[model samples]
Target: MTSLSPTTRTTLGRKRNRAASDRETLYAVLDEALICHLGVVHDGTPLVLPTGYGRDGDTLYLHGSTGAASLRTAAGELDVCVTVTLVDGIVYCRSLNNHSMNYRSAVIFGRARALTGRDEKMHGLRVLTDHLAPGSWEHSRGVNAKEFAAVSVLALDLSEASVKLRAEGPDDEPEDVAADAAWAGVLPIRTVFGEPEPSADLPSTWSVPEHVRTRVSEAAAQ
Candidate 1:
């Protein structure tokens, strides 16, 4: 259980009790979240965009069209911040000021490098595919030369990162609890995969894939 050494940028100035100290916690938050916001500065202006990402050990991979200016800027050896968040529930407190939510979040800071080597690029793409679509890589065709040339991939290290989490129920004030001021509880939140819609062009005989069925079943069981 290696502790995540906090950097100057990652130090929690307030609510330090919510900060996570282990690298495992950071990895868990990243693995559970599907989308991340990537922040970088381009031409002296700050840009933050939500995008899909994949994790491989201590590295995070992001991909976009080669012509995207933001992607180009992020891969130019400049500092970038990436964040992932998962909302568990909404806390309804007795008082408005005490209202909050339960969530797990992570923030990573580092300069990303562009992946140019054929093997490395393919590896990164594999990681991305596995994370985003589970069994898609094995079931679908991989990238060809023209397709590969159209996408840009960047790899960022998880060396400097921070994780904060809150999972308990509402923290109503003592006075509110004693007086029974108002109702207080948690409204749990979740993401579930609905019924799969088959492509119109597909054969009517075709059925949903096992991998997809597994996903829906897992979500329902949760």
Candidate 2:
């Protein structure tokens, strides 16, 4: 468990300015995001692939087919960078170049190791499933030994990470603001959950789980 280091660079760019140094902020953003872009060096070339992930405490778990090439390479001793971004809105400004997005993102850099133990694998799978559908883990079928063995899990420590965020309207210079008359403001964006639709094959006796119901309610309230 390594602690997050301070980011030295600072710029007006949202990628550099909206950064959150606190560990809690980074973890929260990571937890909320459904997908993460994993960046690793393969054969001396950089590779960035988006994949699903789960977080437990200070570690991030990524899973894939056991035969995956990227997973095989990453499972070995190698440093990897994982990034997650959540776009909150579009920032329109008077100047085209000044226009940007409001977003929260987290970048984690660490060495990844394959999880092999049965207990660890189960735990990792539970975390991954729950991360996607909060309460689905308990409601859904558990993984069998064969199924678990067919899947590969990689664990990355969350230490050595950074969080960057940008919120609010565009940053236009006074001169540009006066010269341009375009609408300049933020168009708020969000990930909304639509009305729950029962699965086509779901048994008639089955009812919507509390987790699903609660999440729908929360999304509606938002």
Runs off by more than 4 Å, candidate 1: 12-14, 66-75
Say which candidate scores most in TM-score: 1
Whole-model alpha-carbon lDDT for candidate 1: 0.84
Error of 1 at 166 (Å): 0.8
What C-alpha RMSD separates each model from the true structure?
Answer: 1.8, 3.2
**How high is the lDDT of residue 145 in model 1?**
98
Best by lDDT: 1
Please give the distance, in angstroms, between residue 128's alpha carbon in candidate 1 and its true position after superposition.
Answer: 0.5
Give the TM-scores of the predictions, in the order they appear. 0.94, 0.86
State each candidate's clash count: 0, 2
lDDT by residue for model 2 (27-139), tens:
88988888888877867888888777899998888865422235455336456778899999999998889888898888777777778788887888888888888988878
